[model samples]
Target: MRVLIVDDEPLARARMDALLKECADVDVVGSVGDGEAALAAISEKQPDLLLLDINMPGLDGKALAARLAHRTRPQVVFCTAYEAHAVHAFELGAADYLLKPVRVERLRDALRRVRQRLESQPREPVGWLHARVRGEPIRIALDDVICLVAEEKYVVAHRAGDQLLLDDSLRQLEETYPEHLIRLHRNCLVPANRLVGLKTLADGRVLARLAGTDFSPEVSRRNLPTLRKLLRVG
Candidate 1:
């Protein structure tokens, strides 16, 4: 497992590193003093687990965990001096919490739990969709995608804050994420969760408006009735 240690104390960091060396499977990719640096290290190394400290000058460990709510980049096992924060740590979904002046045997127990958790949790079967942008390959997560629109030979993937143009087709996306995406039009397939309801125009045409977004995709005549029933809008 790739490991990153975050602690403000030098001796504590060194002690933790020594103990981790006993675990032959773990690799200490990087160690940092603060949560800000830890965030950067996680983004760069993409570690499997983090040995985080609770109390710090800028960003505390709990706050850091909250900031990471969007994506579970790395599993966390907080190594702190305080015992009072145990409930709060587990509430944040920490795999384990170890008290300061950690013993070798206790640390081993935490590592075992982490390994078990990783082994038990099933990973998503479908991986990312690779698209080249600005001469570099950019992989977009299927869950982050909002919609896919067919444009001639290319498909335009609309995401939360960005877009990706793909050489693939809309039919390919439908086949891959059939349960998550619904065909809105002949050329458009939007995420099922994003489709809030159908908006009927004065001319009797309808458009599917997305939740938390301003843009609405046109609802095809064939798909209009099914979408209305799905959204429970008569």
Candidate 2:
């Protein structure tokens, strides 16, 4: 399990880092001193777990967790001195809570729970898709993807500067992430949030445009009604 440690105290973070070496399965990806840094790490590293301290100067653990409500969140384990925050910690969907001066045995148990979750959950529980393109392995976070265009036998994921051809089918991808990607045509699926608006021509032709890009695909007649309903257009 990739673990990130977050705490304002240098000594506490160091102690947790040293003890984590006891578990061969756990790799310490990185440690951050405050919640702001932790958020940045969350975007860059995408760790599977976070050993978080509830109390901090700014953007405390609770606030940080709240900020991550939309994105895929790592399993959180609260490690703090105060016991009063236990209820709030659990309310924030923490996997476990360990008191300060953490014991080796308790840490082991917390890791065990993490292992169980990792086993039961899907590999890309965060909507990330793995694909091989140009003879190189690429990890595509769904957020980075702008759209999926179906080719003859593969689905090409279009991004800002790059594109990825996936071996998987568009049907399965749509079924897996219906909330994020919307089908505009039989061969095209676009990021729901990036879709700016639909434009209709004098001849009753419709095109869907996305933000930050001038590229627009012709909207199919079959999906026009649904797309219009989504955009609140008549």
Candidate 3:
């Protein structure tokens, strides 16, 4: 399991890192002092687990976990000095809560529970999307995907400055990757992480702007409300 440690205290981060090394099947991907850095690491490193501290100067662990509620990827395990936030921590879908100073055995138990939970869930598809470019087989990393748009009988996966025609249907993609893709329209799906904002045109058409691409796929009226709520925008 890949883990990211988030804590304001340097000693706490060091202790967690030291203890995690003793745990089998665990890898410390990155450790940061604040939630903002943790969020950036999440996007860049994509750690499987987060060992978080609840009380930090800015963007506390609870707030950061709430920000990440849209999708499930890096599971959270709260490691705090206070027990007062235990209920709230579990409400945030934390895999486990460990009171600090976290003991080696308690840390192991928390990881065991996280491992079991992860094992029970459906695994994400292998990072690559098999598709054709120039009638030749090419593999596109799912991380590079900006969005997926249905073009008549096929779905086109958009990257930063490129696209690929895929054999998979939107429904198949949705079912298989419910965490990565958000349905913006009956015919369009945008990567949850890449979605930037929605814009309404003078002609009463709504378009979604993604992070790395200029291809603004039209958002169907039927799905606009749900999409707005998901994006936390009007």
TM-score of each: 0.57, 0.58, 0.62
Q: After superposition, which runs of candidate 3 have C-alpha atoms over 4 Å from their true positions?
A: 70-72, 125-131, 137-190, 194-234
Candidate 1 local lDDT, residue 153: 80
| Most accurate candidate by lDDT | 3
What global local distance difference test value does model 2 have?
A: 0.80
TM-score, prediction 2: 0.58
Error of 1 at 213 (Å): 28
lDDT of each: 0.77, 0.80, 0.82
Q: Residues 1-234, candidate 1, lDDT per residue (tens digit)?
A: 889999989899999999999876899999998876776566457677899999986657887765454344477899998999999889888989999899888988998888787777643423477687986887876655667888888888887567789756888878877766789999999866456556789998888876445678888999887787755421
Model 1 bad stretches (over 4 Å): 69-73, 122-130, 133-234
Residue-level lDDT of model 3, residues 131-168, one tens digit each, is 89788888777766778888898899876566799978
Q: Ranking under lDDT, best-scoring first? A: 3, 2, 1
Better of 1 and 3 by TM-score: 3
Clashing pairs in 2: none
Q: What is every candidate's alpha-carbon RMSD to the true fold?
A: 10.9, 9.4, 5.8
